[model samples]
Target: MNNTYLTTEELAGRIKYDARTIRQCLKDSVLLEGKHYIRPFGGRKILYIWEIIEEDMLSSAQSNLTIPMANGAVWHG
Candidate 1:
């Protein structure tokens, strides 16, 4: 897996998200530590793994295609 490590600003440009939003909102909520990002040398700087983020983003989007039914079931169309 060729994982691309991206800075917050670089990722923001690629994903069309504001750097502040990525730092404040998506940091610990959607983008998890160690899994989606890494703190090199245990420093404050964060490097996001683009491949992992893309995979998760696509997977989540695909999952969202499934419709929830009232009878406790999902409808995939």
Candidate 2:
């Protein structure tokens, strides 16, 4: 599959989030490594997979009552 890779700044612009927030807050919390982003060539440069991020963002929005529970489970009301 062809994936759209984006830098933090580019993703911030597309998602309307501050680049600093993306790097500091969302980088390893909401946006996980390997799934939402990657360090190319084992270096420090991070590239975000836009397709996966977008998909999760939309899906999370749709499930209003779905809460993240302990032990990696989700609670749906």
Candidate 3:
């Protein structure tokens, strides 16, 4: 239970994205609710799981390093 919980603004600072963009664009599209964030105690406030999102970001960055090949294959770079 040592996960780093972050407010929207705090997360925006760490990830260099606008808090507004995160709320409007990425909230449900990219960042999922239960997995990446949560509304504690059925309240309105949101808290993000920093470690999970960081890992996903790193993995997504690594995924982009691959070269797309023929027949739906990808050459990992």
Candidate 4:
């Protein structure tokens, strides 16, 4: 894919967030592990896919889209 892999610090810089916040807050919530990023060589170090994150960010910015919940799914209000 010739895509560029970015470290936590690099991603934080691009998003203007602290690396710790990305790991603690965004990881597994907004930015999923396998889908949006991966650990290097199965090591502890995580590398985020810039292209995927960019695409996701753009998609999230679209206000017209809504995730449809399945029947019996938890919903408040």
lDDT of 2 at 40: 93
- lDDT, each prediction: 0.94, 0.94, 0.96, 0.86
Candidate order, lDDT descending: 3, 1, 2, 4
What tens digits encode model 3's per-residue C-alpha lDDT throughout 1-77? 78999999999999999999999999999999999999999999999999999999999998789887988998996
Instruction: Report the C-alpha displacement of residue 66, candidate 2, in angstroms.
Output: 9.6
Better of 2 and 4 by lDDT: 2
Tens-place lDDT per residue, model 2, 1-77, is 99999999999999999999998899889999989999999999999999999999988888777888889998886
Off by over 4 Å in 2: 65-77
Please, what are the lDDT tens digits per residue for candidate 1 over residues 7-73? Answer: 9999999999999999999999999998999999999999999999999999888877988899999
Q: Number of the top candidate by TM-score? A: 3
lDDT of 4 at 28: 92
Q: Is candidate 1 or candidate 3 better by lDDT?
A: 3
Report the C-alpha displacement of residue 77, candidate 3, in angstroms.
Answer: 2.5
Local accuracy of candidate 4 as per-residue lDDT tens digits, 1-77: 86679999999999899999998999999899888899978899989999999987877777445555697564433
| Per-model TM values vs. the true structure | 0.83, 0.82, 0.85, 0.76
Q: Candidate 4 has what TM-score?
A: 0.76
Winner on lDDT (2 vs 3): 3
